[model samples]
Target: METITFHSYRGGVGKTVLSVNTAVQLALLGKKVCLVDFDLRAPSHQSLFISSTFSMSPTAKSFTGFLVGDHEPQSVINSTDKENFYCVFSDIEIFQQKESKVRTKLTQHGEGRILAKLFEFVRYCNTQKFDFLIFDCMPGVTYRSLDALIVSDKIMVVTRPVKSEISGLRLVISECYSKLEGAEIFSIMNQVENIKDLVHPPNPLDVNFAKVNVLGITKCLEESSVPIPLLHSFPRVPFVTERIYVLDEKNHPFTVEIETFCNKLLQK
Candidate 1:
């Protein structure tokens, strides 16, 4: 199984939105894909799918339970309403509580236990025969976040056009390179208005510092590039607020392009 993790140095950079959409698109193409909500502190992937009607289930159990020895990792694998996509929801509240308790325990014991639990979870996912395992990681460099990076085969750093976002991307890339030797790292620019319009076009400056593999650009369908590119871009679309019937893949621009991207990835 190939594990792809989406991460960012800071929040409010549309990591969850991109990760969920990417997973949905891949699933629509009939690939067995699992979207793991590893963002324990601020869990929102489940919210994106069910919105206000979020409920805990056998598959949607909290990661905290696994971390604290309350439950096995398999207990947290919850199937989403979507056909081919499943989610492992994070229990943000429980994570925060346990994080506070960490101080009481020996530092290495607390940290090591969490790392071991996460690796065990990854080994379980490998056994499940998933074609693609997408991890929506938490923002910033936390022990939990680093654990995700260590386990992943490929790391895709998502960022916006803002200067602060770029700076954060640099830090994230640097940290990932330092720990994950010889891991494939790619950069994707999300929510891009116009590639040419930006005052300073993003070049390969500090990218080499982290030894990043540059993926092609993704723009809106109207503004999309000719011959397409490796990176899949989408126009700013209306948020799917409430539960609605899934649209046909051909009809939805975002879904169609994303599905195409997944096919291309498989070919590679």
Candidate 2:
């Protein structure tokens, strides 16, 4: 089974959106896929799945619990309504308990043991004959995020077309991504400017500025210390809130973009 991790230098870049929809899309294609919410710092998959047209088996065994040896690997996996699609969610409550043993195990020490638990989960998935194991990781370079990166076969670096992200992305690449030896690194340039989506009469200045933003981000990736190949670019799709568009609105531009991205990812 191929393991892929969706990571970002910063939050609010739609990493979870891409990872969640991609997993569902793959399941729709008749693949046995499991998506793990490794973003324990601020877990959202539980809520996202709860709100979507999908249902996760009610379980108290969270990924964090499994990592801390409070639960077994098999127990943490919550089956979903979608066939061949399963998910392991992280418990934010556990993380929020500043003095909680689970939180201490994850944050203070036992780095090696925590990584082993992650590997154990992957092995369990492999034994279950899963086609893909995707991790919706927390943004930035934390020990947990790095463990996910180290265990992944491919790292999907999600970035946005913003000037502020340019320098931050560079630092992440230099300090974190560059040191990773085995995993193949690729980037997804998300929230890109698409003139076609502009208003009835687009302003000239707005159009020019959009072009510059896209160009700046492109150059940032190409010129980074370790150039990360651009896998796909997703146009900014305005949404009031997060939902699984692939299931709720299959024809949505965002869902269509996700489908196209999944197709390209399968090729790799």
Candidate 3:
């Protein structure tokens, strides 16, 4: 299994959106994919696939459930309408109920069982042998995020054109890359106005890191008032407010960017 972790330095850069949508795009291509939401701050991946899925219940068997021994590690995996795509989301109840405990597990570093449980969860994911295991990581430099970086075979630092976010991504590369031996690093520039403008010289953020692949740019999502439908056939691109881009429509212009991104991953 190829383990990919999606991360961002700051919040509100659409990290979870990119992670979930990428999983959907891969599933659309008929590949077996699993998305695990490690965004303990506010896990929301379950809402995206819960309605139409006939798989495991995020509320019944969540990451917290597994950690607290309420559920088995393998039993929490939930499937979606997309045949082979699956996800493991933290139960909102458990997360809120065990906030302090969860925080302790994630922040206590080496002197805790949370990290060990996390690796055990990683082992379960690897054991499944899914073609891809996408980790929807939380923002900032928490120990949990660092742990995700450690486990990832490849890391995609989701950044925007903003200076602070770019600098944060750079810091992540400078510090984390050395620790992650043999792991490929990617800078997936999100919320770009123009992909072409970025490719030319004097690129945004200057692109000096050799291991960091500028895996093209993904366009900003559009906001909408209409509730986006649960995707069955993807014919339209996604809207920022809804999972519409590649999940709702396949022929949308955004689909090309997703195709290119996933293809680049496959190539690596």
Off by over 4 Å in 2: 109-111, 200-203
Listed in order, each prediction's TM-score against the native is 0.74, 0.95, 0.75
Highest lDDT model number: 2
Per-residue C-alpha lDDT of model 1 across residues 1-268, encoded as one tens digit per residue: 8888888788876677667767767776787788888787778766655553323344456766676667887787887655777777766665456556632331234647777877788788889877788989888887778877878887776666555554565566456545675456665565544334345755656444322322222222113222212254443444533232123335664555456656656665
Which model is ahead, 2 or 3, in terms of lDDT? Answer: 2
The candidates, ranked best first by lDDT, are 2, 3, 1
Ranking by TM-score: 2, 3, 1
Report, for every candidate in turn, its global Cα lDDT versus the true structure.
0.63, 0.88, 0.65
- Model 3 misplacement above 4 A: 51-60, 94-99, 110-112, 195-239
Between prediction 1 and prediction 3, the one with superior TM-score is 3
Estimate the Cα RMSD of every predicted model relative to the unseen true structure. Answer: 8.0, 1.6, 9.8
Provide the clashing-pair count of each candidate structure. Answer: 3, 0, 10
TM-score of 2: 0.95
lDDT of 2 by residue, 1-268 (tens): 9999999999999899899999999999999999999889899988888877786655758888889888888898888778888998988998888987668789754748888988999999999999999999999988888889989999999999888888889888987899998899999998887777666878888788777777887888888777589999998887725788888898898988989999999898
Q: Give every collision pair in model 3.
A: 222-240, 234-249, 234-250, 235-249, 235-250, 236-249, 237-244, 237-245, 238-244, 238-245
